[model samples]
Target: MNIDEKRFTASTEIQKPVPTKRGKSTTTWFALYGFLFISLALFVYVTNVLLGPLRLLLFDPPLFLRINELAIWYSGIPLVIGTALISWDLFRNVTRIRDAKFVRNDPPANRFLTVALTAYNDERSIGGAVKDFRAHPLVKRVIVISNNSRDRTMEIAEQAGAIVFNETRQGYGACVHRALREALKFEDTELTLLCEGDLTFRAADIEKFLAYIPHADVVNGSRIVEQLQERDTQLSLYMHYGNLFAGKVLEMKHLGAVSLTDVGTTYKLCRNVTLRELMPLLDPRINLEFNAYFLDTALSAGVRIIECPVAFYPRVGTSKGGNVNNRIATRLGLRMLWGIFVDWKGFFHD
Candidate 1:
């Protein structure tokens, strides 16, 4: 038999088993309620700290006493309830909900990949980024989706031998959604690698992603490794810790389903088959906070996600996204929190 036939026989002999369904209703209820109550308590505490001086200046003795009493009750009640629910869920049900079974599958029969790079006014980095990924032996094609760039990003990408498309929807999420759709059109490649054209990530990490792809439907690139990241990158100390906090909250929300870190990174690898199924479920209207939304929605639909450590470096151009400043990053983080706790549809307003 030929190599293709041998691979086919091997794959057919050891098919991957479907993940078993677990009872997660109770876990989801407790996790959401616990997060809600704790967040309320923290908000109340911060509010009191900021308004303490104002309270002293504006209120007389009787009124001040009443306000203080109300503050204590507002904070204390949520704090107690949140703490109890979390502790009970942790000790009682987390283990049972977690997937403890061990299963192994054969490596992919076709390792060739279609790479989609998201670009927006990245004239300085587009050419080099295109050439870098095109040089990878496993990368069959490089696609650049320019999100209505006003610069020479599309021109440079095309000159560098990248197939370029313009996504006129005008948002990071829209660009990414367009890139995925374009990558999914290729019949020669079974894997779709999604990344930015800002040069923060490199093509060498494709091997790392391939190593983990057999175990997950999506292999998310993680920038949390201190040793792997460059010192002068956009991921400042504040952004780094904030990403970790958001990741932990997501993990807690799913309870025992998965462990995650660095939900803010744009570099990830998805099986084409998986993306074909997950596309209809995602909302491209989720602007800046779309990565977090993608992960949450994927997990909610039982998609297996695994993290791979990838090196991060400084981008070539001015920052346009959340890492531009601490204030903006905080706002984006809060929006992520709101989507996680409240509803994603409410994000359209604020």
Candidate 2:
């Protein structure tokens, strides 16, 4: 189908109203109260750990004692308020189905999908990654978007038969945004598979994504499965639990809408039409915390998302993303929380 025809069909399908009896007020109140309590607990714990030593060393005894006493007493006020609000919401609200879009048996018209891989200084793995996806029977084409890589990533990707483009804006979000935009230009494929060129994820998972895509607009790959993850991969035990915690926070924000377990995953499949509708709502400036931001924005916009477990392997090259170290991962996790609680636009540095 032509782009205009596809646009019309997508718009028509999206405009169809799904009936739901759930009230928005209750969900919003529940999320707000839960977040307030969790944020207060985290804030208290983090401050005490980070500032307790400094307060003892710098402040006089009287001042430190007063501050400690006040923190101890005043913190309970929010705790009580949050508990009451949540309790009220739970007792007042009745559980109802939020989504009427039941299990969809409607598969894509075309089985072939356009594969887009994000590359940044991945010369060691770009070629192999491109070839692996290109060899997939269902993959119509492979496209690679290099994020200003100073290496031969672009050259190797082209040599491996992938259509290559460079995203001058240097960030994972920018590269992923460019890939989706480019993938949408293809009329032969109805689906777009977004992944990284670091070889951590393989083309073999495309079947898993395809199986789940028929049920939702997007199929996000989850690396939380212990059997699927390789023992020597970059996903340490700390990062694994951290991703799960962040994913739960996001799930709570969109209560009863979606269940998420891995927000840090980069491998996902999106329908071209869904991407066309969702592109404008995404912000590429969110940096390392972009995946969570993407999922959050998609859920908030009423886009359906489902998770599929995919295998995780060791990286062939150096890791430049958030998984590089525990310190960077912690920073990224906090940034994700900040975006989730406050605002995403506040995360833009430039």
Candidate 3:
């Protein structure tokens, strides 16, 4: 072959597209869009028969009840199919969690776990948060990331004996990424506890995380337990259900065999190995719903995860995250869902 011909062949081979199991093909995308179009058309048709003028325009008055009956059956098919699928998944997850055995981590007298707290204008509770995590027997050091806080959050955290660092990039995901990065810096850090310094999640729940860490690569805390959750907490009823729905959707996406009821909780434990492998793949540009993104990416990376109930207390200061209200929480949930099902890499961050 000629030199130019060989060079062109090499360039074409290098530029060839590679198929990925994680991404959908063009044909699959078109088929999905077609299915959605058909479903939407059916919905519109049924609505026209039930509420629109088409019922009276096309059908006789005596046959209106028959048309309505047909419309009911047509509209109810999708709902029935959807409900049955959800129910079957729920039943399978419940049975799996109920029957599965978990190994608990029993630490020795020496501590090796590092606690990392993400802080953003949390001066009111940073000190207490630092102290609470330090009080845990298994926690060796407390690392706090002050995400460009305009207040005294860094000072208070440092005063409470925490190793504080500043992340100039302003976002919850950025702060958490920095926190995990700093936690891994310690030589003796075998496991990293990631939490917020806002005091919504207490340090006392570390034992629950420890108990579940041996069973999974990452142990996520679930605040859905009504008895464990304190009264007047920031997690309202609407926010709780939204978190539960997002968690279930994620569970179905990656970890269908396991049951998950909370995805927005900031309290979680990660083995150093999994954290090192998973952190590099995460995009810090993801904003308020970063926890869901984090969990989804971890699961996609083949990280085993299990959720354990943890006590959730009301924050010492005002809320800044997506849990401020139902409307904001719903928006964040929708973003999380989109990131999970669609193009996660290009959803929010360029």
Evaluated with TM-score, which candidate comes out highest? 1
TM-score, one value per model: 0.84, 0.82, 0.75
Better of 1 and 2 by TM-score: 1
Candidate 2: which stretches are off by over 4 Å? 1-29, 42-80, 88-101
The whole-model lDDT of each prediction reads 0.86, 0.84, 0.76
> Where does model 1 exceed 4 Å of error?
1-27, 39-76, 91-100, 103-106
Per residue, candidate 2 scores C-alpha lDDT tens digits across 1-350 of 99999987775563443533422322344755566695696577567556667777886477776776677667777777767766665454435433354555457788798999999999999999999999999999999999999999999999999999999998888989999999999998899999999999999999999898877889999999999988799999999999998888887676666789999999999988889989998988878888999998887777778999999999999999998899989989999988877789987863
Candidate 1 per-residue lDDT, tens place, 252-347, comes to: 877776778888998999999889989998888888898999998888877778889999999998888898899999999999988887778887
lDDT measured at residue 177 in model 1 versus the true structure, 0 to 100: 89
Cα error, candidate 2, residue 127 (Å): 0.8
Compose the digit string of candidate 3's lDDT tens values, residues 1-350.
99999987765552322222333211122222333344555775667565646656756575776766666667666555555554554555564444433333333233368999998899999999999989987789999999999999999999999999999988998888888888988878778899999888887888788777756778899999999988899888898887887776676564343568998988998888878888789988887778988887876665667899999998898788887888878778778878866756665542
lDDT of 2: 0.84
TM-score quality measure for candidate 1: 0.84
Query: Candidate 3: which stretches are off by over 4 Å?
Result: 1-71, 80-111, 255-257
